[model samples]
Target: MQTYARRLALVLAFTLLPLSGCKRTHQIIHHATSSEPDYTPQILADITPGHIDGMKYPDFTDIQAQVNNLYDMRDVDALWVKGGKPTAQADAMLQEFSNAMQRGLRPEDYDASRWDERVANLKSPEGAALFDVALTVNAIRYLNDLHEGRTNPAHFTFGVKGYNEKKIDAVTILNTQIIDASDVTAAVDAAEPQSLQYKALKKGLKQYLDLVPQDHSDPLPEMNPNAKSIAITAGYPALQSLQQKLTLLGDYSGDANATASSADLTEALKHFQHRHGLNEDGKLGSATIDALNTPLTARVTQIVDTMERWRWLNDDYQNAAIIVNLPEFELRAFEGTGNDHHEVFRMNVVDGKSDDDTHHTPVIADQMKYLVFRPYWNVPPSIARKEIIPHMQKQPGYLGAKNYETVDLKGNVVSPNIAAIDKGTQMVRQKAGTSNSLGLVKFMFPNPFNVYLHDTNEKALFTRTRRDYSHGCVRLQDPPKMANWLLRDNSKWDEDSIADAMNDGQDNKTVLLPKPIPVVVFYGTAWSDDGEMHFFRDMYGYDDDLEKTLNGGRPYPQKPMKAVTEKDA
Candidate 1:
C-alpha cells in the first residue's frame, strides 16, 4: 500500500509541474500583448492615469508612428520642466503629418542627397533618423502654435539633456512640397503613389472631402456652338477625363457614363458653367476652357494648403461659430454641443475682389458682437487715396455725388465745398444710403481692418463665377436672412425689429445680440467635411509662401500675427 501511494504522489508532482510551466508561458504571452502606452501620439488627448486597455486604444503600429511624429516645440529646459507637455509640439506635428499623409508622399520631396550625406557621414542610421524625426517634430510644433492663435515668432527650440540644446530648423521641413501639376500627372500615369507629385495632388484633393448638402448646386456651361461637338470630342484626348474632373468638381450629378447628344452635351456644358457660377450659355468659351484645363493636381494643392490653415485655428469643437468659405461664396454657423456631429447653419455670401490681384481675404476670428444697419462708410485711407481721391481730383463734385464727408485732422466732417481746403491731404467718407457704398444694412464686428459685412449696390458681383468685388468687407448674398438670424430671439429686435431698424437708416444703429455669435472669415482653397473634397482657386498667392515655409525656406519673417486675446480688445 505504501509503494502504490508513493507512485501516485510522484505522478501528481510531474503533472503539477507541467501545469505550472504552462501557466508561466501563458503569463509571458499576455504581458507581451498587453503593454500599451497611456497616451495618444499625434493629436493631444487629455490622458488620465489608469490601466489603458490595449483593445480600447489606437493600433500600436499607428500609435508608434504617431508618437514619432509629435513635434515638440519647446526648448529642452522648458520641455523638461513642463514634464514634456506635448500640446504645442503635438499640434504642429499633427498639422504637418495630416497634411503630408493626405497630400501624398514623394521621393523627390525629401532631399535625398542631404539625407544620404547625413547617413553616410554620420555613420549612424539611428542618428540620421533622429535628425529627420527632430525636423518633422519641430515643423509640427510651429504649425500647432499658429493653429492655436500664437501666430508670431514661428519657430521654437528644445533644450536637450546635458548638451547645449540643438536647434531643429522648423522652416526647413515646412515648405518641402509645392508640387507642380506636370509632376503629379506623370506620377499618376506611372502609378507611383510614393512620388512627390502624387503626394502633392493627394494632399491637395483631400481638402474637398466633405459631406455636402443634397441641395448642393452645380452650374455647368454649354458645349461650343461654333465647333462640331463630335469632331471636338475626337480631337480632345482628355474629353472623358475632363468630364470626370468636372464631375468631381460637382458638374454632372447624373450617371458618369451617360452619353450626351450634341444638344445634351451643350446642356451638360451649361450645367458645368452654372455650377462654376459662369454664364449659362452652352458654349465652351475661353474662360470655360481655362477653367477646364486647370490641373487636378493644382486644385488638390490649393485644397490641402487651405486645410493646413484650418489646422492653425482654435479647434474648440464646442464653440458656436460662423465660418465663411470665401471661394464657395458661403457662410456657415457651426454649433457644437459636445456631440458626435456639429449642427450647421449655412448662407450665401459675397466675397472680395474676384480679380487675381485682390481675391484673398485673410483668415480671422469669430468675435462678432453687434450689427450696424445703414452704417456710414468711413472710407479707408488706401481706398480713398487710390479710388476716390484720384476721381475726386478730376471732379470736385465727386464727393457730393458720392455723399462723402471730407474730415479734417480735427475729426469734424468738412463740407464738400471745403474739399479744395483739405486738398492733397485727402480725407473723405461716403454717407449712409441705398446708393451709398454701404447698401441697405451693414453688420459690424470691430476688427483691425475696419472691414465688416454689409449689403451691396453691386449685386452683380454675387452672380459671377468669381465674387471678390469688395474693397475688403464681405457682402452677404442674403442680408435680410442674416438680419433675421441675428435678431431672432431678442424681444427688442426680432426680424420685424431688424426691418424697422433698416428703415430707420441711421448710422451706428448698434443692435446687440442676445447671445453674441462668433464668426470665422476663413479662406481655404480646399476643405473636407464628411469626406467629399471642395476645391477653390488660390487668389492670394499665399499658398506659395506657405509652401516655401514648409520646404525649409527661410522662416516667414512675418510669422502669423499673434492672436488678439480678450484683454487685447
Candidate 2:
C-alpha cells in the first residue's frame, strides 16, 4: 500500500509540473493538438475585461453585455482561432463585414479594413487570443446592427411602442448560425429582415450605390428659377440637356442630342412625372426640373433614411397589414407572407397637413377594432377652442349651416352656445350625412392621437400631388373600397351591405370586426417599387431629423405624450 501511494504521488507531480511554471508552453502546445483542447485559462489571462471597452468599436458601449456573453459561452477560450491561426469562420465573417455597405451599413463601423492585419498577427498565441475576442465582439455588433439597427428608435422619439427590440443570444447565434454552418454568407444573410420590402430596399441600395459613381462626374445642371414651363418644342436651348438627364434616369430612350422634345421625349417626361409623384403634364416645369436637379448624393441619403426607417418597423406585422405611407399619400393593404403575399388593395389618401405643427400626421402602429358607418366628427378640444368657437362667435348660424350640434358630457343634445363651450360644459359635433365632415363612414383604431381613417366631404383634395389637408386623421379617397377589403373575412358584411350601412344616414352605427386587422401609419420618404426608386417630399422634416440623429447631432426633442381622448371619430 505504501509503494502504491508513492507511485500515485509521483504521477500527480509530473502531470501538474508542465502547467505550473516554465513548462507551461509545453502544456499549451499539447492541449492545442489534443482532442479536448482547454487553453481557456491562458486565453482569459491574455484578454483582460477592459480590452474591448478600450477599443474603437462602433456601438461597442451599447453591446458590451452581448460581448461578455460571447466569451462566457466558450469558457473564455479563443473563438476565431485554432492552433494559433485564424479559423475559416473568421475569414468568411471578415468577408461579410467588408460588404456591409450593401445593406446600408458602413463597413468602417465594423473595423473591417483592419481584419486582414489582425489575422496576420495571429501567429502568436496572445495575438490569436486578442484577435479572437475582437472578432467575436465585431460579430455580435454586426448581428445586432443587422437585426435591430445601429440606432435605437426610441431615442429618436419615433413613437415606437409595444415592440421589444428583439434581443439576440450571441453565443447561440455564433454556434448554430455562423460557425457550424455550411455556408457562412448564407447564415449571415439569414439574420437580416425577411420581409419582401426590406429585400427590395436592399437591392435598391445596391443599385443607387452603383449609380453614385456614374452620376458624380456628370451632374444635372440646375434649371433657372424664373424659367417658365417648357413643353415639347423645337429650338429650345435646354432641350438637349433635358434629354441627357432624362435618359440617364431611364425616363428617356431617345437621342441625347435632340434639339426638340420629340414624341419619344414627351412620353419619357410623362413617365418621369408619374415616377416622381408629379402631375403627368408631359412638360418641363420648375417642379420637374427641381426633382431632376436633386443631387445623386441626396437621393442616396433618401434611400439610406428609408432603409433605417424600415429597420424600425416590427417584423411581426408583415404577414398582414394596412400600411398608410403619409408622404406618398397612399394606403396599401397586404395579405399573406413572402411570395404568397400580394397587395390586396391600394387607394389614395389625404394625410394631415405638415405646414403647421397642429396638423402634421403622426407615425404610429395599431390594430383596427371596428368600423363606424355614418360616423359623426367629434371636434377635438384644440380645434373647438381655436377654430369652431371663434367661427361660431363670428357667425351665429355657423353650427346650423355646417350640420353641427352641441352635445353635453353625457352625449345628450344641447343648444350651441359660445358660453357653454367657454365654460367647458359642452362640445360641438358634426352629424352624419353627405355634408358631414366625416363624409359617410370612419375606420376606428382608438389611438391616443384620436386619429383614424374616414371618408371626407372634400374628395377633390386627393387629386393634389401633395395632399396634406386633413386635421390629423386620414381621409380615404375610396372609403367603399377600404370597407370592402376590411370586411372581406367577416361574413356579416359584404360590399353591398357595407355601402348600405354607410348610407343608412343613422348617427354613428358601429360594426365590430370579427378579426382585428393591424394598421401601420408609416412615414417613408423613399422606397422602391417595381425596380425603380420612388421619392417623395419630406412632408414633416422627419428625414432631416433622422439624418441629424444618424450623424451624431443633437437628439430631437421627445414629444410629450398626450392623454388619450375620445374625439375626431
Candidate 3:
C-alpha cells in the first residue's frame, strides 16, 4: 500500500512539475496538428495542461489521478448544495471552479481561500455536507470539461483554438438548409458518399470523444478450435450497410470489398453492429450507412449531455442499470459495477410510431417489476374511445366479434350489446388472447407513462428498418426469448418452462417479480466508446434542439415541453 501511495505521489508530481522544455514540445505538436488557418494564435496563447495532446505528451497519469480526485469530491458536493445559495467558500469555490473550467486552468491553480469561505458558510452538519457535495459536483464537472473536448486541457475554453466554435457555425448552416426543406432524409440520401463539405464536417465531428468506452477489455472465452464456421446474420441489413458506411466515415484503408470467410471476422462484425445498435443483420444496408455517418463531435456532445443528466440522478445510478436505446428500438439489461462485471441479459424491441405525437417514449426510467406472461391489454380509455369505438360504430357486434367485453371500475364484467349501448358514452374492454393488443408477455414497471415492454400481435413490424409501429409501449419482436431470459435465474422456472408457458397459448398469466430490476429508457443522438462514435437518427429532433439550446436559441425546459407534458401529464 505504501509503494502504491508513493507511485501515486510520483504521478502527481509529474503532472504538477513545471518544465520549460515540455511546453516548447507541446507548442511544436500543437503547430504540427494545426491544419486550421484561424486557430494558430489561440493555440499558442492557451498552452496549459488541458490542451496537451495525448498523442504527444502521453504521461497524463498524474493529471488523470487529480481529475479522478476532483470527480470524487465533486460527486459528494453535488449532493449537498441546496436552494442555489452558496456559503462564502462555496461561492468562492464555485466561481473559481467555473472560471478555471472556462479558462482551462488547473483546479489547484484556483484560490483555496474561496473554498474556505464556502466551507465557512456551513453552520449545520447538513449544510456542510451539502456544500461539500456541491463542491465535489463542480470539481467533477471541471474534470469532465477537461476530458470532453468542451474545455481546453488546461483552459476552460469551449472548443479548441479554431475547430469547435467554427464547426458548429457550419453545422448551423447545414441545419438551416434542412429547415423548410421537403424530404430532409432524401437530401441526406442524395448527399451520400458524402459531399466534400460534409467530409470536412465529418472530420471535425470526430475530433471529440464522448460516451463510456465499449467493454472490449473483457477477453471473451476461447472458442472451439474446430468451430471454423458460424452462421452470421443481422436482423436488419441496414446495420450491415452501416458498418461499411462507418468504414467510409473512418476511411479505413485496408480493403472495402474484402469478404470475410474467417469465423472471427464474421463474429467481430456482428459484435460491432450489435454494440452500435444495428440489427446484427451481418448484411450491410442504407440505414446502417446513415448511422455510420454520424460524427464523433456530436457524440461527444451527447456524452457531455448524458454526464450532466448523471448529476441529476441519485447516486444509486452508479450501481447496476439497464439502458434501453429508443432509436435503436432495443432493450439491453446489464448487471455490474462501473465498467466491471457488466453483462447483457436481453436485447429486443420495436419502437414508437414515427408520426404519433403522443407515443414517443423517452429512455429514462427507474424500477422494473414483474414479468407478465400472456398478459392482457387493458384498453386505454383513449384508444377505446378513439379506435375501438369507431370500429364498433361502423360494424354492429364488433366488440363481441373481437371477444371484447365491457367492465366497470369495480371489475364487474358487463357484457354490453354493441347495438344497444350508447355509442357516445359506452366503452368496451378487450379480453386477453393471441389476437389481444398485448401479445403473450409484458414486462411491467411503475412509471409516469404507462409504457411497458409487451409481446405484439403484429410481429412483422420488427422486420422493418423503421420499426416504429406501436402506439407507445415497446413491442418485443421476440417476447418468448425475453421471457426465457427473465426466467433463467429462477430455479423453479427454466427456459423450457417459460417456453411451455408461451406455447400453452393461455391468456393473462401474471407472474410476480422475484427480484425487481431497473430499466432506463434514454435517448441519445450521439454515443461513443473507445474512439469510435455511433450516431442515431434524432427521432425526436433532440440533437438539433440541444444544439439550438447550446447556441442560445431556447432554454431546455421550454424546448422539450411537448415531450414532458405528454409523458408526465
- Model 3, 222-320: lDDT tens per residue? 334344323434433233343354344453333556643334345555555655666675533444333444444445555444433322233333233
lDDT of 2 by residue, 73-120 (tens): 554557778776667888788887898888877777677778777777
Candidate 2 matches the true fold with a TM-score of 0.86
Global lDDT of each model? 0.48, 0.74, 0.48
After superposition, the stretches of candidate 3 with alpha carbons farther than 4 Å from their true spots are: 1-248, 255-303, 306-311, 318-321, 417-427, 529-531, 548-569
Tell me each candidate's TM-score.
0.59, 0.86, 0.52
RMSD of candidates 1 onward, in order: 15.1, 5.3, 20.0
Q: Alpha-carbon error at 422 in model 1, in Å? A: 5.8
Point out the worst 10-residue segment of candidate 2 by lDDT: 553-562
Write one digit per residue (lDDT tens) for candidate 1, span 1-569: 75565556455545666666754334333323333211122123211121112211212231233333332221111111012232333333333433443433221232222333333322233333333343343333433333331222122111011111212222323323211122322222222222222234354354443312212322334456465433235345545655555555665565767744445556666766654445667666766665665555565556556545543433331133567777667777654443433545676666666463432355555467787787777666555655776786788688777777877656577654334433545456676777776777877666655557788777776666666667667887778778887776766766776776776756657777776566666665655544344455556655675666556532223433333211010
